[model samples]
Target: MTVRTRRLAALLAALSAFAAGCGGESDTDLVRDTVRSYGEASAKKDYQRICDDLVAKELLRSVEAVGLPCELAFKRGLQEVKNPRVEVGEVTVNKSKALVQVRSSAEGQPDSQDTLELTLEGGEWRISSLAKAQPQPPQPAAP
Candidate 1:
């Protein structure tokens, strides 16, 4: 592994350890909290928190795979976003995995629907992946 990868792994491990003893939150709430927190962090441009506390290690690894650290990569992707808003809808949990429905909107942009996959890690819910829903086909105009 590269030095940056090692450092990121160490950072994640440390953060995980810090959260190892936290408990009492239901799976649904935990999953939703993670999503809401990620939205807040993204709006505030707090990429480090989003990388370390909100997202799964695998997602961070994907950023590193492209030769950039998680924070830089995630920030780059959101640079064009403004005044973001996140609304959590449905949350379904099965053991350590969960799926959360979200509606996201930003200034001058159309709202987007997405589902985020989360996993329980070190007693905390962490987002593993996010998939934007495909746009619905428009109906034909009536005669």
Candidate 2:
């Protein structure tokens, strides 16, 4: 093969390798993606999918503990909130656990921050718990 053809083949091979490596989602991205999917599902009122797939089994159990199934309970909670919005911020992943910072708001409600804890369960990232984000102490003013 000519030198030019060899160089072109090398470039193609390198590009293919890079593409393959990037095609799969990183753990951080997977965590963010799960949160984003939850937001979209919430907007569409897809409570079943959220309970059945997006959340961990333990969370689902808690949802059902009030004598209502997961889907019905979630639907009730969201009934008054219109245009629920969720924004995913910083994400930290350690082994099979992850913490995601999320900002959310809905009609007539103030914006709020929450932390979502996720675990790698059955090869999927699922939200295990959610709690209000703790307020950070004021940092000393920079010099």
Candidate 3:
């Protein structure tokens, strides 16, 4: 495992220990919280938190395979996003997997909505894949 992976694993372990009492939190709420945390961490350039608390191991592997650490990849990705904001929408869960619908928009850019896949690991949800959905066209108003 890479350094980022090890960090993330440790973070997850710590979270699991504390999350035992948070069983009352709904799945949607948990997913929403995770996305919100990601946004906050991104704004602060907290790459370690992003890797440990936001994305999954697979994502880390993909970044490392590309010859960049996950933290650097996250930083590079953030550069293209101006005034980034995210709103979590519907969350669909199936067993250990989940898909969170999110609407995100940046300055001078049209809204981009996507479904973020997540996995339940160590009693916490971690982002697995980010597949961007085609932007929906504006609907015409009816009389």
Report lDDT (Cα) of residue 26, candidate 1.
73
Cα lDDT, model 1, residue 54? 92
RMSD of each: 14.1, 5.9, 12.4
- For residues 1-143, what per-residue lDDT tens digits would candidate 1 score against the true structure? 99999999999998888787474577788788899999999899999999989988887788789999888998898988999989999999999999998988888777778898998889989999977886434447899
lDDT of 1: 0.87
lDDT of 3 by residue, 82-130 (tens): 7778888888988878888898777777787888998888888888887
Candidate 2 C-alpha lDDT tens digits along 80-118:
879999989999999999999998887877778899999
- What range of 10 consecutive residues in model 2 has the weakest lDDT sum? 130-139
TM-score of each: 0.76, 0.77, 0.75
**Candidate 3 residue pairs that clash:** none
lDDT of each: 0.87, 0.89, 0.83
Choose the strongest candidate by TM-score. 2
